[model samples]
Target: MTALTLIRHATILLELAGQTFLVDPMLDDARSHDAVEGTSNPTRWPLVGLPTGAAEVVASATAVLITHTHVDHLDDTAIAFLRDRSVPVFCQPFDVAELTERGLPDVRPVDEVTHWRGVAIRRTGGQHGTGAQADLMGPVSGWLLTHGGQQVYVAGDTVWCDEVAAVLDVNQPQVVVVNAGEARMVTGDPITMGADDVFATCRYPGRRQVIAVHLEALNHCGLTRAELACDAAAAGLEVTIPRDGERVSLFQG
Candidate 1:
């Protein structure tokens, strides 16, 4: 059995095989303009508050997985909170040097299939966008976690691409968690998975469940949980749009 909880935008808490894994924690209340540009009114930006028992949840985390070094994913508040902790921070090889530069302790570079406690983890390359957009965003990756005979794919901030689909085909995950909010700037199309892309990803074969996050937390991400759920249902996909503190469990033999 594995328990997966949504802590906030792109933040997840997973308890599998007697270990806890946290992903992309943004616990601060402050909105970041440097990361998401063209936002004049900070108050207008949608904010997803931290979970009710976030501190307790994080304190129990045995390991942390970071998809990227973006401010929203690894903010000052989150960094300070994890700095003193003893858990290992798993991230891409490209991010290891950057994390070390930030003086983050116990930061480990994940380059291939590995295990944290008893959970099997596979890291694969991910594209933030196409062409120039991807180059500007730098290297990003997604995680495939298998524990208790169940596979779950956590698609970090990425647009629809062949790599993502290939992961689905290879891993055949039972559950897929996507960072889908159709995030965009005034100048370009969405940089993250739009509703249509989310539908396509979730509709893939062998995906028993799908969870959507990274919505309504920042100014650039315009989609809401309700809208995502509606779109998923309209597309005949079974999906769950969990609130910040919501928990959804999966049992496997």
Candidate 2:
């Protein structure tokens, strides 16, 4: 069976088919804008204040799944670190040229169903926002990973929309990891999945387990883990808000 571990915001570590898969790693010491503003605090003390031993993890990774090129998801430090590694990097089509420009040798764009180390990956289109926010964020996407006879969906930074619902309808993932920070600006609605959106996403017809993250770690995001958990329970949703460095696993029946 595949194990899904939430490493951090928009980051995850999955072990399946005797291979490790790291997704959207943001492991820099001062990588977040929240740190500069003194607003968000990391849930656990970072090991050496960075994604230390990242090379070791990357060394074991069968492939790296990159959803987008945002600084939090893909930064200079991470890019530099992975450049020397031989593992293939899977990313959205728009990000392929950029990765190539940055000197990554085996960068592949995720456009359809593909497999790495016996894990099935299907890339689905995503919507970032309604108007200008979507333009600024570019083309965000999500992934459906089928491994060991089960499915898991990782929703990249997004608000509640039809595309997300469509992903749910098609994949019917048993476990879901949502970027649930209720982030907002002074002028517009929240950018990331707010508590309400998280509820809606989790309440989708066939989802069995849901894990919410991307909270209390960035300036733009303001929701707390406790708050999200409480909200989910109140909404009668089965959700887990994991502490940083914590790990969870799912098994197929």
Candidate 3:
């Protein structure tokens, strides 16, 4: 059975195709790092702690998938956690050099589709922000994981745009994972999906599941699960906002 466990922030433990895949693990303790410069609500990063211990968190076998190398997505503790292990690290081309430099033995860049043990992981494009913010934020990638008759889309740090629309129209994944914290810098628009964007994703014409995450962890993330839940419910939109450590089914609901 395909399942997902939200570890914290943008981190997730995904079980699919008879293997476990850890995605963008940020395993540091609460408030260990300072706030991201220029972002609003200048509080320390990772406002909360992981639901479980790091060792227990990553004890399962399989590989690691990193969408980007942002501190919130990939930190020193997480890097140190994987250094001695022999799991394959799958990442976008932009992160290959650094991840390898960090001493990860099996660093693999998924420029496009990467096949592994009957699973297909396809790299999809996205805009982290608009204009200068987007450019400065650098390149981000979402991932489409397909195995047999099931498909799951892990939409990385991104806003609602043509690229996301195309992924929805073309891929038609039954389960969609969205970074919906509405995070932003000092003086710009939201860098991630807000309530409107999440609603847009849920409103897509089909039967599927929209899982909204990236909330209540960092200071810059202005939106909360309570807020999103109320807004979505009022708008008659369907979404699953799981708490940290909660395991969610990958099937459409």
Best by TM-score: 3
C-alpha-based local distance difference test score of model 1? 0.79
Query: Per-residue CA lDDT of candidate 1, range 1-253, in tens?
Result: 4878888789889877788889988877644434456433334332645665556756878899999988778776778778778899999988988888777799988888887777888887777867787788788888889876778889898987898889888878878888988877666566788898888887666546777888878877878888888877787777778887888886543
Enumerate residue pairs that collide in model 3: none
- For model 3, the superposed segments whose C-alpha errors exceed 4 Å read none
- Per-candidate TM equals 0.92, 0.88, 0.98
Score candidate 2 by TM-score against the native: 0.88
At residue 9, candidate 2 shows an lDDT of 71
- The positional error of residue 213 in candidate 3, measured at the CA in angstroms, is 0.8
Per-residue C-alpha lDDT of model 3 across residues 183-217, encoded as one tens digit per residue = 98888789999999999889887768999989999
- The superposed Cα distance between candidate 1 and the true structure at residue 52, in angstroms, equals 2.7
Whichever of 2 and 3 has more TM-score, that candidate is 3
